[model samples]
Target chain A: MVKKFMALLRMKYIEMFAYQWATLAWSTGAMVQPIITMMVWINIYETEMESFILYFSTLILVERLTAAWDVWDLDRDIREGSFSNYILRPIHPIHWAIAENIIYKGLFLVVLVPAWLVSSFFLPSLQLHLNGWEWMLFISALLLGGGIRFMFSYSCGLLGFWINKVTAVYAMFEGISLFFSGRIAPFSLLPPIMQDISLYLPFRYMIGFPIEVITGSVKGADLGYGFLGAFIWVLIFMGILGFLWHAGLKKNQAVGG
Target chain B: MSIVVDHLNKQFKVHVRQAGWLDAFRSIFKREYQIVEAVNNLSFTIQSGEIVGFLGPNGAGKTTAMKMLAGLLHPTSGAITVEGFIPQEQKAEYKKMMSLVMGQKSQLIWDIPPMETFLVNKAIYEIDDNSFNKTLDELVALLELEPLLNKPTRSLSLGQRMKCELAAALLHRPKVLFLDEPTIGLDVDTQEKVRRFIANYNREHKTTILLTSHYMGDVTALCKRVIIINHGKLLYDGDLDVLTEKLTPYKLLEVHLPTLPNQSWETYGEVDSIEEGKVTLRIPRERIREVSARLLQEFPVHDLNIQDPPMEEVITLAFQEKSHG
Candidate 1:
């Protein structure tokens, strides 16, 4: 399994380079919305400008690190019947998607880490101040966040076996996630009820919880609760993915000859 | 038997919609579905080291059956065991022993060279270095793929890409191969090359191959036996020559004469076509020799040639006979 994953990663890495300009554009393009939101918050809350800058900057980095596009890939592949190629292979198809996720995220890290460091040199608010334990916890939360996001996207993609418009359905879910996952604003700024709701839903664990961990907004028992919530969501999505995969294979028409 | 398909069937629930915009809009609210029986009660067994042509017209369920055999689609009812392994189980051991290639769909990564896909498969199949290198060398030489291997799949011509596809599917040297339209849309020369390669490879490897192709030349050149299907059901399953003889039990006799015969041609045979000095007749198999001899004695025949009916015509007659019956 490890050997297969390594090969898949290498192949994905080469494929990514073939679209290097597109990769660069996508990594940089994702920053626009958060940066624009940061500017608006700065104008609205002049006294708390530094904290808002820190929060949205961390949001951009965490978001990039956790992004998943497998839904689009799966939807297109299932619709075109090219997915039969993977199905016929000896290895499970999910490993290929997982490898692609790892390669793309690794590229994002390579590009974004330097950009964050250079920006921090110019703007002190962009810098992170965390102890060793806190850094470890933050990294754990980030990986968990990435895992939850990947499972979520892949599960949605598996719905393509039943529905023709799965990407459109995923877009609807993504729109809802925008407000609930703290993309537009931090969870602390949301109303009390919305914050409680976010805690129960899986959206917070995907993007918002990781940002909270890095920004020191989640500490003490709250940090434990965040991990607990994220862990539960992971198990839930795993269950959902397992079920979809088993049922979807039978449901798959394998559309094209 | 290398592959056994018993009462195999596949049905699809397809959404039915009319052509106009109003019906399309109405279908969004209240959709209608119709069941399409793509493959119905299809049963055929292929022996080890046999190359059998899966013959069918468009929408005749040939591809559906192939997909089911490859375990890509679940059969509605029936059993298929390849090498004593149930295909729909999709076990890793079963997959490692078989390969499927669809000419209409590509397995190669488009923007990258074909070598990358081969490397990916090598890992997935866990092919050792020595075996991989040996098999790849043979395939490259046979397919003449050394130049095309480095070129991006998108830049390669259709024929070149197809050769690479074949090589990719065969790197692990699968024991059983399922090919659907393996030579579709290629020029005659390229088609002949692919046919010859398949025949030679099968001969050398003793591979069990079940191939489906619209091109009659592919079947005639590579397959001695054929299983014909129509409307998802098996119509005929036997030797190619036997099916041809059964459906079209006559020979095409073309006689070249110095002058045109003034008598009615019906007394001779069924006149297929006639020109100034050349006449073609459809003669029954039993009387071909006697008729040819009599024509030579009566009319100063310059040249005479006798041949069986074309494969396309034979298959057409087969379908017509089955449907009408």
Candidate 2:
């Protein structure tokens, strides 16, 4: 399995290079919304520019790290029947998607980490101050966040077996996630009720909770609860993914085969 | 038997919608569905190392059956066991032992060279480096893929991409290969090359191959046995020669004569066509010898020949019989 995963990672890396422009465009373009949101908040608050800058920059990094395109891929492949190529292979099809995620996110880190360091040298707000344990906890939250988002997108993609317009459904979910996952604002700035609601929902864990961890807004029992909520959501999404995979295979018409 | 399909069946629930916006909107609220029986109670067995042609016309459930055999779709009912493994179960060992190639649906990564796809399969199938190298070398030589290996799949011609697709699918050395229209849309020369490669590969590897093709030449060249189906029903399954002989129990007699006959030739046999001094007759197989002799004696025959009906004609008759029955 490890050998196969490495091979898949290598293949996906090469594929990324083949579409270098698209990869660059996507990885860079995704930052625009958060950066724009950051500017708006900075102007509106007038005094909290540094914190707002830190918040949105970290959001950009965390969002890119957790981004998943499997829904779009699955929607097209399953509908067009090219997905059967993966299905018929000895390895499970999900491994390919997972490998792709690892490679793309690894690339994002490689590009964004240096960019963040350089920006921090210019703008001190971009610099993070945290102890070793805090850094470890933040990294754990980021990985968990990525896992949640991947499972959610992949599960939504599996819906393509039953529905022709699965991407639209996923788009609706993504729009909801925008507000709930703290992309537009920090989780701490949300209205009290919304913050309470975000605690129980998985979307918050996908992007918001990780940002909260790094921003130092989630500490003490809230930090414990954040990890607990994130872990629970991971299990829930993993369960959903498992059920969807098995059911989707049975539902699969293997269209165009 | 390398493959055994016992009463295998697959049915799809397809939405039925009419044209126009109102109907589409109504369908969104209240959709109707019809059950499409893509494959129904199909039972057939193929022995190990046998290359059997799966013959069918458009929408004849050929691809559906192949997909079921390849474990790409779940059968609505019944069962399919390929190499002692139930295909729908999709066990890893079962998958390791079989491969499927759909000419219309490519497995090759479009933007990358096919070698990358081969390497990916090597890992997915856990093929040792030695075996992977050996098999790839053999396939590359046989398919003449030395130059094409490094080119992007999208840049290569359809024939070249198909050769790469074949090579990629075979890198695992599967024991049973399910080919759905493997040579579709290729030129005659490329089709012949694919056919020869399939035949030679089957011969060398003793792999069980179940192939479906619209082109009769593919079947005639590579498969002595064929299984014919239509409307998800098995119409015929046996030797290709036997099916032809059974469907068309007559031989075509062509006579090259110095002059045309004046009287009706109905007394001898059914006149299929006549042009100038050349006459063609459909004579019963039992009487072909007698008819040929009489034609030679009376018709000023220069040369005469007897031949079975073409495979296309025989297969058409088989389908017609099923439909008309």
Encode model 1's per-residue lDDT on A144-241: one tens digit a residue. 99999999999999999999879999999899899899999998788999998999988899999999998898889999999999999999999999
Q: What clash pairs does model 1 have?
A: none
- TM-score of candidate 1 relative to the true fold: 0.98
> What C-alpha lDDT, on a 0 to 100 scale, does residue A53 get in candidate 1?
85
RMSD of 1: 1.3
lDDT of 2 by residue, B17-108 (tens): 99999999999899999999999889999999999999888999999999889888899889888989988888999989998999998999
Q: Pick the candidate with the highest lDDT.
A: 1
Backbone clash count for every predicted candidate, in the order shown: 0, 0
lDDT, candidate 1, at A256: 89
Backbone clash pairs for candidate 2 read: none
Error of 1 at A238 (Å): 0.9
